[model samples]
Target: MTIGAGGGSRSNSRSSRTNKYSTSKLRNSQHGSGAAGGGSALGGQPLNGPSMGPGKGDIKHRFEIIRKLGSGTYGKVSLAYDHKNEREVAVKLIKKSAIENKQDLVRIRREIRIMSALKHPNIIQIFEVFENRDKIILVMEYASGGELYDYVSTYGSLPEPEARRIFRQITSAVLYCHK
Candidate 1:
């Protein structure tokens, strides 16, 4: 449900307020944008990574769109060159409407805030948050290695010891969080 120009209220639950990005909203927005003739701005262009936020025409920023990485219900990802930094970054542009409710927006904002607080090798890093009139752009470090689930799923189940080792590694991350 796309909200009006003004954003909605905030949520209270931790899960509801944390990691609120959902596949459902991603799907809906993807469909709607497709209907509106907002095809990807990428195509044959070379992409450094995924970008988030407005399209090439819509955004007034000087970011040169290298290629489109992908998109979900909330927004599309593009590979862009940051003219100022002279570096590549993945930009995620999330529309306000992709949010299910006010709580969802709050959760996403919280996640961005948390990302700004951390610096670790094991954690995904968010570099900056750029806000235009209605949308939020999340510039993040691109992980090109793909997801661990994909590797696990493609290779089949791992041996018990290997799984345990991975679990231990995750446990170490949890411990770091606690610290």
Candidate 2:
């Protein structure tokens, strides 16, 4: 991800404020066959490999889809149970057709690569990625803690200490990414 430079200075002060977080480049990497690697890819565990995880036809067989968490133009996210590990996971389903152009596809692939490479506790963990003819499935760590929006809406505002703690964690994750 390449950060873009902001526009030139404008006569008006109001137009001077530019978005600092603008991505200019999106790079894609080839993920061979969407197959899981045997060793470290499985989180250092010795298992049946990626085959043990859910695939196209046997997705429901391996993982019990609890319910739909949310949906967007890409696809829907569902809460699923990993029958093999007996753990809940969030499955992000992205339709192949939803990606209109090569750029969009590259962006998605780049996102997958970034998620797979990052290993920070504060960030969501992506366990495995599955792709078939029609959809791409991202098996991710289930976040039991409710959404921040919901929490803030319900509680109005967080206490100073708690807010600081959360801010610290967010900054730490951002620092790790920068590193």
Candidate 3:
């Protein structure tokens, strides 16, 4: 989906306060601790919808990798097309070998849970998670809008109004997470 440059004003600020309490309650119910939590933050529900078993083949069998988007110590992110959905997506490929211990694995799983739980318009959607013998592939929503830093570098400083608009979107997203 294309994220535009404006339209983030909220008329009822107090509604967020009410939503905070309800959201927390819903989260608590949906994400119980330990094995009871099931496979996902949504209380046993699969995060990526249906199961796609760990098969012995290339991830490219499912997604057509378009290009490398970015990289890090853990893994690389690539722009890809989902064959099943016929849409663009970002795939994060994390090597299984890079996970040092059980704790590290747990942390990665937690990150998946958190990302999958997020449903805000500003937040990227986690479409699917696939694990092979070597890597963990996360298929996520593709944001065509480049990084904020890159945007700033290309355009120089934004006007005050434009900056505020972006800032508001960022703050609203952060507030949603806080809730």
Each candidate structure's TM-score, on Cα atoms with residue i matched to residue i, is 0.57, 0.67, 0.67
In the order shown, what is each candidate's alpha-carbon RMSD? 14.6, 17.2, 14.2
Instruction: Please name the candidate that would achieve the greatest lDDT relative to the true structure.
Output: 3
The better candidate by TM-score, 1 or 3, is 3
Clashing pairs in 3: none
Sorted on lDDT, best first, the list reads: 3, 2, 1
Q: Candidate 2, 23: how far from true, in Å? A: 44
> In order, what lDDT does every prediction score?
0.50, 0.55, 0.57
lDDT of 2 by residue, 14-119 (tens): 2221232122211112211222211112222211213334323345345555566677898877765665555666777777788899899878878887878888
- In candidate 2, position 99 carries an lDDT of 82
Poorest 10 consecutive residues by lDDT, candidate 3: 34-43
Give one digit per residue, the lDDT tens place, for model 3 in 1-179: 22423333211121222322322111223322211112222111233432344342234344555567777776777766555555666777777678888898878878887887788876777877765455666777777665667777877999999788778778878899999
Cα-based lDDT at residue 149, candidate 2? 66
TM-score (C-alpha, index-matched) for candidate 3: 0.67
Backbone clash total for model 3 is: 0
Candidate 2 global TM-score: 0.67
lDDT of 1 by residue, 16-50 (tens): 21222321112223333321123333212212223
